[model samples]
Target: MTVLVAISLTTGILSGIWGWVAVSLGLLSWAGFLGCTTYFASPKDGIRGLGLSIVTNMSGVFWAMVIIHLSSLFSVEILGYVVTALVSFFMCVQAKKTWLNYIPGTFIGSCATFAANGDWQLVIPSLIVGALFGYTMKASGLWLHQKLNQPNSKLAAAEAE
Candidate 1:
């Protein structure tokens, strides 16, 4: 089979498994899926992508927590918006660092945290797991493609003849 086909099958199967595991563990599968997407979308690939995904995503969670805490300290509701604005500025500025350069990952991570009602305990692990899924999917897909195209394989036999 073609590499694209192999990757597609691998992604579909793993995504199903991921969804099942997330639901079974009482974790948000969607959050994990976001993390996986973040990993794939990262500028880097392999281990670097995984690290960047986790770091940027967790940074988002941290900033969201700050927004929540600081917002609660004020009596005025508008102050929450102000805090968000300020925190957002810092989030962008943080891109100057190499590890935290994935701006979209941070945004996605923060969005997931907020969606989970700031449940970092659950969200953090889910995101990490999702990033792992992304890595596994890519690795497995390439492996499958290589195996199918190997010299002794049927496809290779046909091509050789």
Candidate 2:
């Protein structure tokens, strides 16, 4: 959809500007895709979804950091994996009950954070920028939808077909 496209483009632009922030362009695209899925699920709840997604994403980063630190201290790879698996299972269950609508964005954002291997401080701003872009895209899409649905527009004629 046009909204997703806009979100992706905006995210890319933000990523370029904050190149040192550690959130890769690929991650931004993933975030945009998540935003699209959330929008599809509930257009009116897009903003709330974005907010929850950001919080959940940062929580994931914190979780990863804790695991990584403990693994380093203990020098046990399996320990880290076990903890991650356990946490993931519980988180998914809770996600369904609490942040059901924002799950996609939250999950993808966390994945991106882990993949980037970036700093926690940087992750906050990066995710915030991504979320803002998604909201902007939604606004643009609404405008486009309005214009396209206008009685005098060619889109109206196409819609009649």
Candidate 3:
């Protein structure tokens, strides 16, 4: 819901800047349909984004395969929504954080890039990197969660500021 949208928008914007079109789409749609969802995506949320990203990244490739067959108009929209739902559920479980959710989108995009060149072998390393990215996102989420949740710390001060 709110968490997914927020995460999506944040991640989408970042991904767009980073050149991750698939993930950017997920985030944008979430933002368009759900307002509160983005709150969950901010660094302040927790490990929610990390968990969501794992599914999103993995599923990105799965869904993109769908787009190739069906009309991009229909399949892209459907897959975007599917991504939102999956990521939303994970966010609820993780307390709503969205740092790691960027993986799948980037993964899918990477797949597209490599697949275009017939370099399927690169996916393996990308996967490893994605997992490591997920781990880092989780750890950072925990740390940021603690700091942001604290009542009167300098880190909290920075957050407030």
**Reference-based lDDT, each prediction:** 0.92, 0.56, 0.40
Candidate 3 accuracy as lDDT: 0.40
- Residue 114 of candidate 3: its Cα lDDT? 33
Supply the TM-score for candidate 2: 0.61
RMSD of each: 2.4, 6.4, 12.8
Give each model's clash number: 0, 0, 11
lDDT of 2 by residue, 104-161 (tens): 5545545655665745565555566655555555565666656555577576689899
For the record, the alpha-carbon RMSD of candidate 1 to the native fold, in angstroms, is 2.4
Q: Could you estimate the TM-score for every candidate? A: 0.91, 0.61, 0.30
Where is model 2 poorest over a 10-residue stretch in terms of lDDT? 35-44
**Which pairs, if any, clash in model 1?**
none
Question: What lDDT tens digits, residue by residue, belong to model 1 across residues 14-44?
Answer: 9999999899988889999999999889999
lDDT of 1 at 94: 99
On a 0 to 1 TM-score scale, where does candidate 1 land against the true structure?
Answer: 0.91
Q: Which structure is stronger by TM-score: 1 or 3? A: 1
